[model samples]
Each structure stands twice: as C-alpha cells, then as structure tokens.
Target: MAAEFDTLAEWTAQVATDLGSSFKIPAACRGSGSLAVLDWLIDELHLSHGGSLLDCGAGMGGPAAYAVRQRSVRPLLVEPERGACRAARSLFGHPVVRASALALPVGDDSFDAAWSLGVLCTVPDQLALLTELRRVVRPTGRIGLLVFVARSSEPFPHPDGNHFPTEARLLSLVEKAGLGIEDWRGTEEMAGPTPEWQSRVEKVTAELADRHRGQRAWQLAERQSQLIGQLLADSTVTGELLTLRRR
Candidate 1:
C-alpha cells in the first residue's frame, strides 16, 4: 500500500506510462479518445500564462500534464489514492500532494484557479470539498470542474455507496461555497448502451461467477465497468462543467 504523502514516483508505473503523448497530436495523449482530457480542460478553462492552479483528483497526471504542456503551468495536484498520486508526479512534473478534497493543505488565496475532474459525486462530503476549494482560490479566481452527478436512471452507486448529488443540487453546493456557477451543460448520449461491450461483460461475469473467488473479482471489475457504461451510455448521466469565479 502506498502512503498518501508519498511522491507519485514509486507506486504504480503502468498508469504513468499510459499518460504519454502522441507526436501526431502535437505531443499530447490521443489514446483515451480523439481529444485529450487536458485539451478538454484547456479549451474550457481558457487559462492564461502565470495562472496558478490546484488540480484536485488529477488521475495519473493526464490533465496535470496537459496544464504543464499548455502554458508552462505547474498545477498542484491533490490525490488521496497513492497509485494515482504516484502516476501524477511520475508522468508530469506537477507536484503531487497527499491531501483529501475536503481538507486541502494549501493556504487561502493560494491559487488562481482550482480544478477537479470526474471526482465530485463519489466524495463523501460535497460541501466540505467545495468549501476547501473556495478557501484556496484568490478572490475572483475561478474553479473549473468536471463532475459526474447522478441522474434518476443510474444504478450501482459507488462501491462504498457514497452520495451522488444531482447536477442541479451540486450547483447549489458550490454556491454555498461562495462561488457561483458560470457555465452549465449536460451531455446526453442519445443512443443506449452499446451491445458489444454489454454482451462481453455479461458472458465474462457469468463465467467467473461459477467460481466463488473468481466471481468476486470479476464482479468488481466487470460489473463496475458495465454500470459505468450503462449510466454514461446516452450521456443520460452527464458531466457538469462549471467555471465558477470565487466571490
């Protein structure tokens, strides 16, 4: 097990290697999709040079790497997962700090902006995280966030059954933190789940279920992926991207 404070250099190497760039895409990662997650942030955030940033829940340094590549940005990343923190530091020079979203270690007015992608819903204390986010930003600094809030059609809550605040409610939570939402868009994939992945998952799951030990392992991996695919299938489950300026 990796400690929270450990530098993201030694824990996991696989996720780090996956964070590489394709020269064809101008020294950017192109594997995850046609567009990089970092590119996505840069486009939406539109940050300028000398923009100090805090990236909460930066996974394997994808967005962090993007930030550095874009404008020589040094994003301070916060991650509780040791493997992820290791990946962030190893893949990108961004400093990886072992910190919980609810209680950041940085001082007030320490950052020009804060971003946390794909991490809000599973957080146990949404309000706490928002408050902490508000604390770090200089007055008028913005928070660019990509969060997956639950909708009625979703199933299989967090493995730990954490709260999944709805998108509408999530904005209110941010407002409570003293930042007003400046952008809102809900992406819905009109089509349902793809047959190919669903079929493959069902077959693999049943096969593994025949064995007690294998069933548990397979269920965790296969079931979770299936659930994620289902919810995100039509973008019925969507991300709320907010550029909120701190008040």
Candidate 2:
C-alpha cells in the first residue's frame, strides 16, 4: 500500500488542515468540474432532502460535502486513497469508506443516486467500475459522470494513470453496464469559474506552495496538474457530462 506521506493525498490533507474552519476548503478541493457543472448535475439528479447519495471515487469529499450543504442529502463516500479518506472525514465530518470503485463495500441498491467525477479516465477497468456503480444504485436511481473523452485519433500527451475513451466507446461501455443514457452534454466550453471559487482555489494553492515547496508530494501533484492542464489546452480531449439511468 502507498504511504500517506509524500503523495497528493498528503498535500490535500494538509491543505484542508491549513484552511481549517474556512468555507473555501470544499471549493478548493473540488477537482476538475466547476460549480456550474456540479449545480447542473445536482439539479438533474433530482436529489431530495434526506435522500441517500453514494459518491464513488470521491477524493477528499468536497463535492459530496457540497451536495450535503445544498440538498441536505445523506452521503456515503467511497475513496481509495487513505490520506484522502482521512481528510474527508476530518474536514467535513462525513462518513467515508476507503475502498475501490471496482468493488464497493456497500449493499446492493443502497443509494438513491450516485456519481463519479473525473474518475473514469483514471481507472483502467472502466466497465467494471460502471457495473459496480449500477449494482449499488436503485433501479430507478440515476448515475452521473464527468468524463474526459478523446477527441481525435492522433496521439497526444496525457497525465499518467489516465486512459481517456472516445465518445463512441464510452457510450458502448455504458450500454454494456446495463445503463441507459438519459442526457449528455459537452462541458469543454462551460462557463468559467466564479470569482469566489477562483479566489478560494488560489488561496489553497498559495498555501500549499508556501508550506510544501520543493517537497516530493508537492512536486508530483504539481506535475500532474500541469499534465492535465496541457491535455485540456491542446483540445485532444473533451469533457463530457452524462446522466445515466439503469436499464
């Protein structure tokens, strides 16, 4: 198992600790998707107050926490990283399970809705991940995904641990996993982040640099961020937001 120290998880955990009691922690930890995207998905999922939600591959639990604050829904977070799980629990006081997306520890049909953001490309077994998500969600439940789909056949640089699928391939995999597409849209050109959101993120970034400058964990995380930014800038991959229903 990977140690908690000198990893992106450690950096994020430290950021949460440094930003203690500040409302910016959640905003700072929200991965690729912007606030607009989250709001749209939440509205589309039709999450009711007090309903159950499962956040698979939920790193640091920022989005899950945001959902809780917005809709008062009960969230069970499943994250694979140990340090991130700890951060989520300590920072947001949410129940988090350190587990893999391929085989969730939850019971069958345990959630009203589920979602995975910026996670599909990172997992090599995309089909199994989707299948597991389907198993845990009710037959009437919805599953939302924010994926980076390949836009062209030409080879382009991408961050390590990423295996982006073409749109057609992604659709086929969804069908294979017994999921029906309710709606899909492109988010590559979604509105920019709000000033407040940007500000929160900047503060966290500045703090991380000041605290862990030249550290191995910080260097690794910075490289990963740069690679992801390059992929987005080159137009080699496009963001796709899909709302799926169990068939």
Query: For this target, which candidate reaches the highest TM-score against the unseen true structure?
Result: 2
lDDT tens digits, residue span 132-163, model 1? 88889888777777667677634554433346
Question: Candidate 2 lDDT, tens digit per residue, 1-247?
Answer: 1322225555666676767666435433556588778888898888989989999888878888889888999999998988778777767888989899999999999999999998899899999999999999999999999999998756777776789998888989999999999989788656777887787777777777888777866776777777777777777788889999998
Measured by TM-score, how close is model 1 to the native structure?
0.72
Question: Where does candidate 1 stray beyond 4 Å?
Answer: 1-12, 15-40, 153-162, 187-222, 234-236
User: Can you give the TM-score per candidate against the true fold?
Assistant: 0.72, 0.93
What lDDT, from 0 to 1, does candidate 1 have? Answer: 0.59
What lDDT does the true structure give each of the candidates?
0.59, 0.81
Best by lDDT: 2
Write out the backbone clash pairs for model 2: none
